[model samples]
Target: MKSRKGVRAAVTLAAAALGALAFDGTASAAPLPPGGGSWDHVWKGSSGDFTIYVKEYGDVVSICDTKADGKTPTVWVGPGNGHTTQYWFTAPGGKGACNTKSSSDGAKYRLKRGQKYTVTGCAWGCNTWDFRDRH
Candidate 1:
């Protein structure tokens, strides 16, 4: 009986250690930006193809496409309040050139401060990230 109890405790400790390691790895995989009062940029893709870049500042987001590649860079923004409405943005310009869209250039959507939103970028494929408007 004593040996059985010892084995059980060792197994539990090992499982707990493994669980902690997994959680730590997952947390480190996607790190959030610092909250409020600053701008943050998030992007996806590589130099071999095209890159989709997003500049988020306060309630505004700007998207840029780095290559032509026949793939259009797009951004999807949705407010995190259980709302189904999502706004989108696309880079504007000719192919094989850098195209950008922001409030200063043309039509753009505005995010609400203090609201959390999911931003997804797509050029070759789609990648999603979360952003909170704290400013």
Candidate 2:
């Protein structure tokens, strides 16, 4: 009986640890800038080198390179409906080259409202975040 209880306790502890790790791996939206306009959602890269902002009622998505680490910041956006195609957006990166680029900047693509999209940011590595269009 004592051995069984010990095994049960160990299993419970392992499960709890895994739950915590899973929660940590999930990314949450970042706070918007002061007077930066209404944004449906925003996310900062895991490496703190870039930011992704969804705005204009989810009709536009913007990628900004926030750091001057000599590495370009890129974002991949795709439909959340299990679609396989993804569009890439990137910002100019270099020392003193913090800039923002958007999907609508060059008429690349337009996002639809009320649609879910998967966004991934790449700098040192790649991290993914999800955004849903909101009016």
Candidate 3:
């Protein structure tokens, strides 16, 4: 009887584990705020370096770079790990936007409505540029 109960408990635990794994496949929104995307792949431009960062405690979006150091100090413009500051907005078509409040200026990172920009080691305007997915 003791052996049977032990086996039953093990089976129950296994079933619960499988159930949890099953729910893992459910679709969910990005953990980051709107306009946030993985910046693992970066695009360099003539303007400067642009990185996608989160904004406003996951409320808004912004892009930052050393190219615009004159406008504001570049903060919250690095790779994000799903932080509230790293979340971004993905448009209906997969395009996304990001913003940050850590910068000295208030400009946010935005995806150009109809234009596409190249990512290079150099700097570019995040407000007028759309980050192309490297994935």
Top lDDT model: 2
Looking at candidate 3, the ten consecutive residues that score lowest on lDDT are: 11-20
Model 2 is weakest, by summed lDDT over 10 consecutive residues, at 11-20
Error of 1 at 87 (Å): 1.3
- Candidate 3 lDDT tens digits, 11-113: 0000000001011134432223233343232222234333333222222233433222333212232222212232132212121222333223333433222
The whole-model C-alpha lDDT of candidate 3 against the native structure comes to: 0.25
Cα RMSDs, all models: 17.0, 14.4, 22.0
Ranking by TM-score: 2, 1, 3
Candidate 2, residues 10-99, lDDT tens digits: the string is: 100000000001111235332233235545556666667766665543255566665657888776766673244356757674422333
Best of the candidates, TM-score? 2
- Can you give the TM-score per candidate against the true fold? 0.51, 0.58, 0.20
lDDT of 1 by residue, 1-135 (tens): 112111101100000000001112334322112222223444444332333334443244545454446666676667663244456756545233333344344334555556676655666655555556544
